[model samples]
Target: MIGSLGLKLARFAVVLSVFALWEVLSRTGMVNPRLLPSASDTIAMLGQLLQRASVRSDLAVTASEVAVAFVLAVPCGALIGFAIAENRYFAEVAKPLLFFAFSIPKSIFLPMFILVFGVGFSQKVGFAFFSTIFIVIMSTTVAVDSVKTEYLTVARSYGATTAQTAFRVYLPSMLPVLLETVRISMIFNLTGVLLAEMYASRDGIGHQIATWGENFQMEQLLAGVLMIAIIAMTFNELVRWVETRCSHWRT
Candidate 1:
């Protein structure tokens, strides 16, 4: 307990130190204030931005896109991954292709998505889904493969049916790893949505940030980045807590 508390304190101290450094550098003229706004100014700007109806709407739109993409990606990826892992021939043929696709920069496909879906909510969601699904598929495949052959053998010895073995043996074994995959996939999904929004869309938190940068609005730009950082960190921590809770299922 003490160790955990100390670790939390250390993380908090690190974040506080970063903000302190930002404040000092900007206020003391060590860095140009126009380029790097003071932490206080950025926070103030974020507060003001949050109060605006348009900014709030943009935040909502981005959130919706992320949520929809995640919902669509997880089940589809898991099913595809499980199917591939269960078939040796398919695994040999598809794993390399999936890895090659995953290695490619997903941003390159944004224009194709735009051409198909236009610069709208569907485009952002589709791009996000495309970016996120590959990682989830790879992770799920690994998780399914990690299940022990002995467990399956024992289930077979007991005359367990395929469905029974899947539920009793595979599900328990894969749950923890799948939980971790969920956390990682969300990061990809959020990034894809933001990149789509930034690249083409007229309205979204990402678009707002891009606009602020293009207009040389340093304070707004920094504030927008800080807002995204906060959201990402908070969601990561929440998923991590759930992962920790589910980790006991791992053998």
Candidate 2:
């Protein structure tokens, strides 16, 4: 544990070193201060936003949207994936359709979603769901396909029922990989929600950032950007921790 903590600290030190270099360069005019504010200035801006009630409210709304999208996505994606896995015919029938949907650019759907779901939370959820579904579906399908036939044969040899093979062999086999896919899809959904909010929102972190940018309030803009990076980083770290725990069985 001590050794693990040391490695984590060392990694953080490297990150801080890079930020320190950027701060020095920006402060000394080696880099354009206007274009690249020092880390200290960005941190001060972040502090200001954290103190404000409005930013907190905006963050809560955005978080709620993200959570909702994720909740809706996981079960649906898993079901589609599981269906395809259970039968080769269904896989062939569905794979092309799913691919076509994924291939279409997400931005193109914004107008349609707005038309259907309107400029509200429904639209945001739709955008987030659209952005992430394909990743989870495709990943889950691949994981299912990769399950060895030998395992199925062994189960059958032992007189395992179809349901038993699916539950004991197939489901357990896919859980870790499916979870990894979900983590990646979550990241994709987060980006989708933020971009959707930026496009059309009365209250969200993305909306606040856009508002600040429009007013050329560099400090506030920087603050919002910093907050986003922090949030994204937090998600990444949590996913990585879960991935590490889940994948230990693989080796």
Candidate 3:
């Protein structure tokens, strides 16, 4: 724990040093400050924006889309994973398909999603779901597939039913592995939301950044970026807490 804390502190120190470098460079006119605002200017804009509750509302909307996509993906992905795990024949067929599906650039489908969902929350959620669900599916499938034959044999020796073996062994054993997939899915959703907001939505942090960027208000753009970083860090910390709590059952 001490080592982990020290590592995080070191990372934060590095980030601060980078910002200081940028600040010095901009203030010294090494680059035009208009194109790259100083950290102080950006921080001031962040402070001012935080004073308005509406900015929080914009964040809430994007967060809501993220939550919705995650909820929709988790059960479906888990079920898909379970089906694939139960059959090697299907896994051989579907694994490549999943890889191809994941590799498809989602922006290519945005037009169809926007047309179907009418540039609304549903479309954004769909985009987020597309971006995240495959990761969850593939990871969970691999985790379940790799369960030891010995464990299954032991459960069968105990006269355990299929459901009992699954609940008591497979699912529990896969939790740690799935947690990593969840973390990756969350990052994917974050990127998807940013893209959706930038291209389609009128009321998200991405939209705000685009609007401000067009007006040459670098400070506001920086403020939006800072808010995104803060939200991502907070959500990631929550996920870490949940992971630690879930794994504590092992101890």
* TM-score to native of every candidate shown: 0.94, 0.89, 0.90
**Prediction 1 TM-score vs. true:** 0.94
Report RMSD (Å) for each prediction in the order shown. Answer: 1.7, 2.8, 2.4
Residue-by-residue lDDT tens digits, candidate 2, 122-213: 88899999898888888888889867899999999999998899899888787778778877898889988989888888889988999988
State model 1's lDDT: 0.95
- Quote the positional error of residue 114 for candidate 2 in Å: 1.4
Q: Choose 1 or 2, whichever is better by lDDT.
A: 1
lDDT of 3 by residue, 2-85 (tens): 799899999999999999998998899998999889989988889999888878788788888989998988778878987987
Identify the runs in model 1 with alpha carbons over 4 angstroms from their true place: 249-251
> lDDT winner among the candidates?
1
The 10-residue segment of model 1 with minimum total lDDT is 242-251
Alpha-carbon shift of residue 163 in model 3 (angstroms): 2.8
Error of 3 at 57 (Å): 1.7
Ranking by TM-score: 1, 3, 2
Question: Which pairs of residues collide in candidate 3?
Answer: none
Please list the C-alpha lDDT of all candidates, in the order they appear.
0.95, 0.86, 0.85
Off by over 4 Å in 2: 1-14, 159-163
